[model samples]
Target: MIKAKITVTLKKGVLDPQGKAIEGSLSALGFEGVNSVRQGKVFDIELTMDDKATAEKSLTAMCEQLLANTVIEDYRVEIFS
Candidate 1:
């Protein structure tokens, strides 16, 4: 079995309201030097595979189809056996 890990994050220059809300609360709690914040997604996938090429291809397809929103988010995939 192969373990695939995925991360998805918003691109720079995109507005993140959830991050901003968290930052605001942080500042209210006396956290200093807080100016900006961002948020992202992480996913772990498990599959039965042996070849790296096949695993990578499948992982890529998964990312492109459902794991991430390519229009506004960037993604990374890691495969381990």
Candidate 2:
């Protein structure tokens, strides 16, 4: 079995309204050190694989297909033991 942790986030030029809201709330709570915020989506996928290469390939395909929007989002994946 293999585990994948996928993170999907808006591209740098894209605006993140949810992240901005969180930043506002943090500031209101006196978190003056908070400068900027960006929200991201996370996905955990588990699958049976014969080897590491297969696991990585499957994880990449999963991210490309459903975990991220290729037009305006960036995605990263981490494999866990």
lDDT of 1 at 46: 86
Per-residue lDDT tens digits of candidate 2, residues 1-81? Answer: 888888998999898999999999999988988889999999888878758788888888987887789899999988887
Highest TM-score scorer? 1
**Candidate 2, pairs of clashing residues:** none
Clashes of 2: 0
Give lDDT: candidate 1, residue 73.
92
lDDT of 1 by residue, 21-79 (tens): 99999999999998788989999888887888899998999889988889999999898
Task: Estimate the overall C-alpha local distance difference test score of candidate 1.
Answer: 0.90
